[model samples]
Target: MADKQLMTYEVGEQMNLMALLKNVTVRVAKNGKQYLDLTFEDQSGEISGKFWDASAADIDRFQAGRVVRLAGKRETYQGSPQVRIAGLRLANADEPHQPGDFVVHAPMKASDMEEQINQVVFEITNQVWNRIVRFLLAKHRKAFFSYPAAKHNHHAFEGGLAFHTLSILRLAHSVVQQYSSIDAPLLYAGAILHDLGKVIELSGPVSTQYTVEGNLLGHISIVDGEIVSACNELKFDLNSENVVLLRHMILAHHGLMEYGSPVRPRLLEAEVLHQLDELDASIMMMTTAVEKTSPGEFGERLFAMDGRSFYRPNEPQAGGPAVK
Candidate 1:
């Protein structure tokens, strides 16, 4: 098969544009006029292109998430590449799409991330916390297996949200170990359940778009409310203090009220969990954003996460002589 990894191509660059390759999403956009939105990918990266004047017959040939080939012109639009479609058709059923063609299989493997999460779950000794973890892990297995962390933000890949949450909890647990006064078990539990409500907040698989409840109730409210209800049903001896502490972790996971946190972290465990969550999320976003761009290249503006474009190269030394 021709290399589809080079999804990004400049105008006048001669390359075979095959749509039949795997992990491609095809959408139609009538921007001023009719255009085919070709979302193609390979192991290296994925790119979106516009195919102007795409015929209706071609449009009928494929549905969303189907692989197709494009034979047309490639041009740059505001620094990003777009394809002008001359021809497009679906691939044979026997033809397999490359796993790397989709964002799910882009940089990180979901299995490894899930394995780490499983390891963390096994480490929990508290029976109540263990049961809650098991219930969530099992109930959202399918979605967690295929969902992205966000529609377009950090860790937005299959199993990403769970993977991200697990990492945060792990780090938070490690950080709190230094403080002897804090309850490590409760803190660990809080970290684990902090973002469970995300299962309801964001849709999974094809898109990680926010649901109506996510937009209104938000993850904190949904998670805290669910935890309370579940604890009530199971008749767990959830002390009011512990309940409040855990709820605070969820409610303040976002770290700031303006960012949707119901309140700032007050307790030591909640505060630690909040900081760890923020640290993990922000680092992931920055790392992923920087990695996607070429060395010395400035990343394209990230709207869903970081608002500004980031330069990829390390800054030059202040006193070093300039390169010849």
Candidate 2:
């Protein structure tokens, strides 16, 4: 068997390796010299690198998504490891590298996640909601499974959208079981379609960025519009109360107007959807932060979490004495 490729390398390590060129940009230094700022990645993780005093010819030769051989010294910048590239060139055809080895992916298998999500759709007994959810899922199944939840926030990896949606669906199922009054169909639909618009909102799975529609309308409005289009195609009544409620859930899933929800969640189902969405996103953010930090130390401040840092304890602690 071939030796295992490293997911990450240590700082101060001088090495030559093959990795995907995830991103590249050119910028001028203070001395009027140009440099290439690049991000390289393998299944392990991503790292930034700077090719100082790069020539125009060099820039022309490098492009994103291509596998390349890189020789560099790893160094630290602001507590993160980065590379100072000494040399770089496209990998030879004979090089034992596979594109799949360089990309990050969700922990769960994509096919398994898709199957589980389909099972949830099958459970939605409400005909109208069930049809709408199935239509949207079928229409965007490719992008839905391929795109990240965000460019660089929670669930920002391949298959993230489905992973995030499935996570929320699981949470909503428990919430509905606990609160019998909650509408199961609406909540399930909301969980699956809350971020459906992100398929068009994000550029793609690799080195993603916001598209024109994403930047102008955002995912909330984009999916709201999608609901209208889907309703038209399906010949569903536009003015039906069920349609309005579902649309409202998507519009108000952001929960607060300040957070970009055009309208606040007014219905009970909408409110629950918003809360569950927040719960899933917050948990992912916190877990990601904690995992990145060393045990017994505080993590870097998370700007999205109100700039609060999290602590990762070295030892697991049991719950305090149970109340009598």
TM-score of 1: 0.75
* Residue 303 lDDT, candidate 2, scale 0-100: 82
lDDT of each: 0.64, 0.84
- Summarize candidate 1's per-residue lDDT along 1-324 as a digit string, tens digits: 654434556556654554433232444454554555555544444555655565676556555556656566665453344555556666656664443344454244667666777777776676677666666667666666556566556666666777777778668667766677776776777777777777788875443468999899987898888777777767766675545656676788777888888798787777777778778877787777676555556766666454677777754568984333
Provide the TM-score for each candidate, comma-separated: 0.75, 0.87
- Per-residue alpha-carbon lDDT of model 2 for 60-155, expressed as tens digits? 878777788988887756444578888898889898456556777988988999999999998888888889999999999999987889877688
List, in order, the clash count of every candidate structure.
Answer: 6, 1
Which clashing pairs does model 2 show? 7-44
Deviating ranges (above 4 Å) for candidate 1: 6-12, 15-38, 53-63, 71-87, 97-103, 106-115, 122-127, 177-182, 211-216, 237-239, 304-306, 314-324
